[model samples]
Target: MKIYHNQLTKTLAQGFIPVWLVFGDEPWQKDNSLSTIKAAAQQQGFSELIRFNTESGFDWQQLMDEYQSMSLFASQRIIEVEFSTTKVGDAGNKALVALAERLSEDIQHKHYANDVIFIFHGDKLDGPSANKKWFKLFSQIGCYLPLYDVELKSMSHWINQQCQTLNLNLAPELTQLLIELFEGNLLALAQELQKLSLLFNQSLITLEQAEQLVIKQAKFNPFQVVDSLLLGDCGKCIAMLDQLQQEGIAPAKIIWALHKEISQLYNMLNQLEQGESINQLYKQYRIWDKRKPLYQHALTHIKLPDVKQAMIRIADIDLLSKTSSEFNVFILLADLCITLYHGDKTQALSLKYG
Candidate 1:
């Protein structure tokens, strides 16, 4: 029923299923999984991939008719039903529920014809227990693949897999850099990959080739900006802040990210006091590899109490940024930065943990 991307790929490669449900919060995983499903479906003589949109006032009868009516040209067809968060509660939900119930009903004998295969795509579903009835039924008959974001360290491996799929040579280090610069977002990365696949004639992707791509294709990803801040690079932090301001990433999200990282750093330091090595601790906490240096510096320069104070100060700042009649976002952020730069140990030691 619920399977990882790799497992799903292996199963799908063997043959097509009656249905496939590819949905997740991780964009890259979801897209890549669906792409594999499509590829596998194509190999199984599912030439026609019909996409149905419920948002454009879809005729429910017409869709049912299409599903009922077998393809004259082909023995099997892949019907893609795309349902976003918006349409999920309305026409799309009703249609899918109806379809599921329709297919579940037993015919005159034990046989139920399923010539039309379905692939349902939407936002990441939480869990099978929390999902709707239609979702549960899909798992009974087909595969439910859940995808998560690829880590920075595993980018090279991901690139190798991508190259293998596209049947091209993608440089390892270059792929790693691309993942670093474009981590957390897939739509942007995918577009860049498409460009590279078209432009690069060499079967083997070199680091040099990837470096140019990263510079040109790298837009101001919020995640990269957050990574810089976590590393405590004020120069870069300020530069990214300025770039984000210029590019219009909401200051609220930036504040939230900074606030989260500060808390995490504080927690990491707290754990170190309990006899955790920095190297082991970082990996244990699932800390991003790019954040290692920043945290290393933070632990060396900061004490537990100081971090606690900074966290409290930022919490207050977050509250004020939302409530104060004369709210000053700049002031809040600057204050947080000041504490980060020069907060004292004595006051921090006196503070209580949340």
Candidate 2:
């Protein structure tokens, strides 16, 4: 049966399913679901775990062999397979189908019902792959969970739920602030909540406290750099870029944040140019009242063409960072930010940076 990440806890309460396929790009949900399943399995006497990663050249037959083989140390065992990609080849597809068939037989006969649990974890499976024979077979016989990223509309509720889990009390305004600061990054939000729990120790956290704490933590996040860039602060953007590089943050992450904001800005600019109401667009995008001025300033100073060119430069930087070792992504990123900030006046400045 197919279920969502939110359904896992209630499903586990009913009983442990023998086979599970958990796949998603959302790291927090995927990891949480796996932890819940593993805990449930352990409680049901799955004491031994055999893990396999489906890296290149992995033998599909080995999984079959392991499943068929009995555990020596423990009566019940869990077989966990982690695949980086959903595209298991022909041999793997056959092996998985065969394994699912065996599990179905076991379920029908009530044989080895509690002795073995199979889990397949990986990135999100595309729509076409979900209709494949093996995947369909597994779904018929076991639980298939496809996790998704938390949408911005539901982020505050998610934050509140997480705060409850951590025994931290955050006011509505504080919760909204946290959501804005994290910018839809669940892992970072979770970490910040964990930190708040440590510091506050079950006490109610005020907005002032949250502001102070999040600002300190914000030093390491790429969002700050993106904010600086969008606000057209070239000096602050360059400084934050340097800080991120010094702190060992990946260039791809910084590039991704910038690309996302710029893409949104480009879209918003087009909508405004087409005579759409700014207030309506802001509401549609869920832009907070405080952030309207930032968007307004950026739209006023930066041309739509400049935003488009910056996106192209971002793409180039991403490609060069991955494909070429000698190219300096940080320098390229700084150059892009300066170009976006200064537009046509960046010729001598871009040359100096280059």
Candidate 3:
């Protein structure tokens, strides 16, 4: 059966399934869900926990042996299998299907002791993975919980809930600031809230306090890099990119910022070329009053052809980042910044890494 994150507790109250598959890309949600499961399992006297990571060249026989052997430390055991990616090879696919079939057979034959639970977790599941035999079998006999990130439109509510969890009351302005700054990065948002809770001891946080704490805390973020790009400051843009790298920010976040800016510019240019009013477009796009000049500068300096090329290049960069671990995405990102600002890919590449 498929279960949502909200239903996990109720679902666990009924009984424990032989297998549980909790998977997603959201770190905060994934961590919370696993913790909930672990707590529930421990409450049910599943005392011994054995964990395995399916890294490259992992031996399936080891897992099989561990599953078949009895736990020496406790009466019950929980086996956790973590996958780094969904690209589990043919061997893994067969092993999972075989285990699912055995679980189903054991339950049907009343041979299951209800003493051992298997939990598998990993990255987001793609469409093709849903149709795999192993996924279907596991869902039929157990539960598959897939977590999704909160949408930007509903981020304020999420932030409010998180603040309530931390026993901290956030003023309206501070909440809005957090939504704007940490929308996609929930881990960072949680850390900041914990910091606020520690400093103020769960007191209500005012807008001024938040700004004084958060705004001055960082000199570079993905949003700032895109802001510099929109202002046509290639030097500052590349410098921020360097700082972001040195600060250990993920390249995916940088890609998201760049893609968002280029996509908005492309949409604005398309609407303008269609004879739409710039003022109406600005309102339609929800451009902030303080940031209208940045959009205006981008609209004037960036043309449709350049925007189109950038859209394609960013997509390529995103794909390459996901597929090729060794590829330095920052190089292409820097090249993209120069191309978008200067409108010359050849010159951009030649001047930087040529």
Candidate 4:
């Protein structure tokens, strides 16, 4: 049966399934869903769980061998297969195609005596690629649940649900602000909830607790560095860059992150200008998570036009590093901070990349 993630509790209450396919791009949901299902399966007698990564050099026949094997000293077994984007090639296709063609016989029949539960998970499936025959087969024959990532527009609703799960009360305005502050970090967001829930003990989670607990500790993901720089907080931005370099985070990886943030910020500011309500705006624009701050901080800047221009220069620098022989990503990152800080003379861009 094709099931949406929201129906998870219902599905588990109903009992076990021989096959479950947890496919999605949402890491938070994916992790939670799989854990719930796996827990239920284990409690119901599924033991000796076998885990496989798509990147591993295991062949198609080896996959089948594991699937067909009986559990040693256990009543039932769970086999989990994680399919990455790297699995899109010839070998991956072969593995998937083989499983799709034969699993019906193995799972439906009782030849092995020991019950076997199979779980196939994929995070990188999207667009035309998700419609493939092998993938379609899993959903068609058994339990198929897909979890989409949280977008800014849906973040409030999601956060509200998350709060409700923790029995925390929150004002609508405060909820929106919390989502803005936490952005796309559901795991971190959940962590913040637990931290507050212990203190509040099911009482309402106020905006104040969120600020001190969530906002204060949230290490600015390097994703926000460019926007932080563009907003003229050079000191914090540069300090962040230096910290990242010191931590051994690759310069190229940092640039790519900044590039994504700049492009996202440019769009977010444009949407904010069209009189979009905080709720309506997040939905209409795809800004979520770290990108939320780009617009938040941009509001404190001169204008969107200046931010866009600064982003263009950042983009040019990125292209140069990738295509040109000289790949001084460090210098390009520094220049990015300098441009964003000076682009708007209204506020002083602190040159600290901490």
lDDT per residue as tens, model 4, 1-354: 888877987988886676788877666788899999989988888877888877656665667888766557776888898875523666667767677667765556744343778888887557666677777766665688878656657878887787778888776767777675566467777777777777787776667765665552223456557556655677767766765665567667877777776666666667667765655665666657765665556555636766666677676666776777555566557667666546655224422322
Those runs of model 1 whose alpha carbons end farther than 4 Å from true positions after fitting are 56-66, 69-75, 90-95, 105-110, 127-130, 165-176, 186-200, 203-213, 216-247, 256-308, 311-342, 345-354
Worst 10 residues of 2 by lDDT: 345-354
Evaluate model 2: give its TM-score.
Answer: 0.66
lDDT of 3: 0.82
The digit string of per-residue lDDT tens for model 2 on 1-354 reads 988887889988987688899998777787788888999888888899999999999998888898888789899988999996789989888988888888788878887547878899999898888888888888887899998777657888888888779899887788878766565468777888898899998888899877877842223467767766777888878877876787689998988898899889989889999999888888989988867877878888889877877877788888888888776688888888987866566544432234
Report RMSD for candidate 3.
8.8
lDDT of 3 at 27: 82
Residue range 97-211, candidate 3, lDDT tens digits: 8878888898999998998888899999998887889899989988999997766667887778777788888899888888766755777787888889999876788998778
Measured on C-alpha atoms, candidate 4 has an lDDT of 0.69
Ranking by lDDT: 3, 2, 4, 1
Residues 1-354, candidate 1, lDDT per residue (tens digit)? 678876876787665477787776776677777887888778777788788765665676656677777687887788887765433555555776677766666322435654577887777676542377767777776777766666656766766666666666676667767776665556677767766777875467788756655643334555665566555665655555555666666777967777887888877888899888998888788767856776777778766766777788777767776776465455456556546756762344322222
TM-score of 1: 0.65
Error of 1 at 12 (Å): 1.7
Candidate 1 residue 84 C-alpha distance from true site, Å: 1.8
Clashes (backbone N, CA, C under 3 Å), per candidate, total 4, 0, 1, 20
Q: Mark the 10 consecutive residues where model 3 has the least summed lDDT.
A: 345-354
